[model samples]
Target: MDKERIIHRICALHETCPGNIVTEKEAISPELIGLNIFGEPLVGFASATDELFEAFKNSDIVGPWFLSPTEWLPEAKTVISLFFPYTEAVKSANRKATTHPAAEWLHGRIEGQAYLLKLIESLKKWFDDNDIKTCVPITDQRFEVVVAGNNFKQYSCVTADTFSSNWSERHVAYIAGLGTFGLSKGLITEKGMAGRFISIIVSKELAADPRPYTGIYDHCNRCGACVKRCPAQAISLAEGKDHNLCGAWLSKMGNLFKPRYGCGLCQTGVPCESAIPRKRRT
Candidate 1:
């Protein structure tokens, strides 16, 4: 299918999907029952043979555990990456809370992810119906993510790292021309950093979107707003993001929120929350 067709389908799905709204059963409060979880999604495509995919095999990037598009789908011709930005309701709610995640934000994190998965599956089925093969690595049985210790060697080239995942949506999004990494390690797109990312590798040939920039952090303005907004103090201008500290904080939040846990303080009320922060006035 053409890029316009794919984009149109995705937009339509986002507009009508029941999963995109926080249902009463899934919401933490009655106020959040009908809250919209996500805004329109931004989609980008990359050639399966993009050199950046190979570069991701390096230890510094994603390690050997990082699977390229071809590795996920042998005949993969294009990698489709999507960034679904949180709705304004979610972002505003989170902005009001300084430490804990707001109910709307919590639903956005948990239910929003569920919606993304459903969307991916729908897209995959569409490709299947068209006799085109598709693979979503995150949903594949082979997908693996090591959150603690240095046992990632079995899954990656990383021998000493404490955290590693076989497939990273953010990294793939970058290669697909979606966005760049922010100071908090979030992918900052034109729509901003407060969002979730998902990707699929397909056999259908689609022209790759040209990357508008080269550097990995080109979109980040280094505003340090995220640093000050971090409740865990996990971000700093000098050191960037501290995943260990952030993970610990999330674990503590898990204890409090149970099945639904998240802290997106760094993502809200920040210069990069809703858009690429404009260059500081001289």
Candidate 2:
């Protein structure tokens, strides 16, 4: 199918997917029963052969552990990146939160991610039905995430360094022309840095979208709103985000919230929360 057709299917599925809605049993509060996890998504396509994929293998980038599209699917021709922005209900709840993650934000992280995976599975079925081969690296057996201080397990994909992964959705999204990095290290898209990303490799040859800017941090604006919002003090204007510090705070959150833990403070209550921030006037 063409890009338009694929986008249409995804958008349509998003609108009707029962998983996108917070059910009474899953909501943190009565008010959250009908909460929608995400708004309409923005999709972008990149050629499987994009040079950026190779660049991502560098030590300074995602590292040698990074897997290229072809590695995930030998016949891959395109990489489809999807960004799902959090609905206003989700973002607004977290905006006023301080030390702890808001209940709404927690649901968005845990349940919202479940909904995203469901969406991907639906798309995979669509591609298979069309006689197109596709691979969702995140759900694949080879997918592995290495977090420092966590009990580690070896995987066949790659011995990724701590705080890294064999396939990074955010990096993949960047290559797909969906957005660029912010000072907080979150990918800032046209829809803003407050969102979740997922990607897949396919055998369909789709024209890659043009990256609107050159620099990796072009859309950031360096406003540093995220720095102040961080309850963990994990971000800084001079050094950006410290994953270790961020991880420690998330760990603490995990203890408190158990089944659900998240902190989107850097994502909301900022200029880039819902849209790319304009450069500050000189």
Candidate 3:
């Protein structure tokens, strides 16, 4: 499909989609966020791991600037990263869930799972219709490839990890122009990082990645709210964060919420999100 028509179709999926923030731009972010949320396995995508799943369990192999990851993808030309600000954006913008149970991912419920898959099915049909050769996670194996080591966690590949690679989510999102970096090292979007979710789609034919939909980083330079609030002490004065600590902290908050899933420490209450001040509601 022509690029314009592809975007139009994505928009149509948004116009009549099941989830909230149905627009194409807002729907893709979670994929990247998922990439980020599970950062360990992604580094393996760059490096050739004898045990692809085990490499996902360890961050020891990750190299700086994705040198290993880049070397791994020999068949790529351009990668287009997409952003979907699902519930975080919804909450940040103070938009109510139009229906009964909330549709957000952070609540950790599988409620939105099937609806999201159908949305991606529409997207996949769009790509196939357009003749875009794509290579994201497919079937149960791709997702299992990442989280196979963890016996407790099991999610569908299509649930997220769309068009994934080894690079970190923040790096990909920054490359795509969807958001800026926060002191918490979260990708802060116009949705204030709270409401934002991220996804990635790579095309061998797209030539250049689309210019970032969010534009340049401006206010991000002045704020360190994420830094101030980080309880894990995982964040660095520079960039290196201890995911072990961050994950542990998020786990700490996970037990409190009696929701269908669990608590998302940084995702809940969301001082970092509310701090950004609301963008004018369209």
Candidate 4:
């Protein structure tokens, strides 16, 4: 299928999917029952043979655990990456809370992810119906994410200082021309940093989009707004983000919020929350 056709299908699904809306059973408040979780998604495609995918195998990047498109789907010809921005209701609610995650934001984190998985599955089925093979690496049975200090011997090569996964949506998004990394390590797209990313590798070959810029942090303005917004002080202009500290905070949030836990303070109330921050006027 053509890029336009794929995008149209995704948009239609986002518009009509019941999972996209917070239902009464899953909502934190009566007013939040119908809150939209994500805005229109931004889709980008990359050739499966892109050199950037190979580069990701390096230690500094995603490590040897990073799986290229071909590794996920042997005949993979294209990699489709999508960024689904959070709706204003979710962002605004999180902005109002300084230290803790708002109930709306928590739902966005939990329920929003549930919707994303369904969207991914739908896209996979679409490709299957088209007679094209596809694989969603993150959802694949082989996928694994090893946290620091975990006794996972097979992944000992991955250091304990950072979050390491067999497949990283943000990294794949960058290769697919979606966006660049922000100070808080969030992918900053034209629609901004507060969002979720999902990708699929398919046998269908689509023209890859041109990456508009060079350098990993080209879009980031180094505004440091995320640093000040982080309740865990996990972000800093001098050091960037500390995933360990951030993970600890999220764990603490689980104790307070239980099954639904998240803290997106660095994502909201920041210059890069909803759009790319403007560079210095001078």
- What Cα-based lDDT does every candidate model obtain? 0.85, 0.86, 0.39, 0.86
**lDDT for each residue of candidate 3 in 214-245, tens digit (9 for 90 to 100):** 43333244333344445566555464344556
Error of 4 at 272 (Å): 0.7
Prediction RMSDs, each to the true structure: 3.1, 4.2, 11.4, 3.4
Model 1 lDDT, full chain set: 0.85
What stretches of model 2 exceed 4 Å from their correct place? 147-162
Instruction: Report the lDDT tens digits of candidate 1 across residue range 1-282.
Output: 699999998898777766998787887878777888888899999999999888877665567777888998999999999999998999998999888999888888888999999989988888899899999999999999865444332222223435777788988888888888888888889999998999999898999998888888888888889999999998889877777788889999999999989999998999889898877656
Cα lDDT tens digits, model 4, 1-282, are: 699999899898887766989898988879998899899999999999999889777665567777889999999999999999999999999999889999989999999999999988988888899999999998999899855343223212233565688888887888889888887878889999998999999999899998887978888898888898888998888867777789899999999998889999998998888888888665
Model 4 Cα RMSD, 1 decimal: 3.4
TM-score for all models, in order of appearance? 0.94, 0.94, 0.54, 0.94
Tell me how far the alpha carbon of residue 241 in candidate 2 is from the true structure, in angstroms, after superposition.
0.7
For model 1, what is the alpha-carbon lDDT of residue 146?
64
lDDT of 2 by residue, 6-25 (tens): 99999998987768889999
Clash totals in order: 0, 0, 20, 0
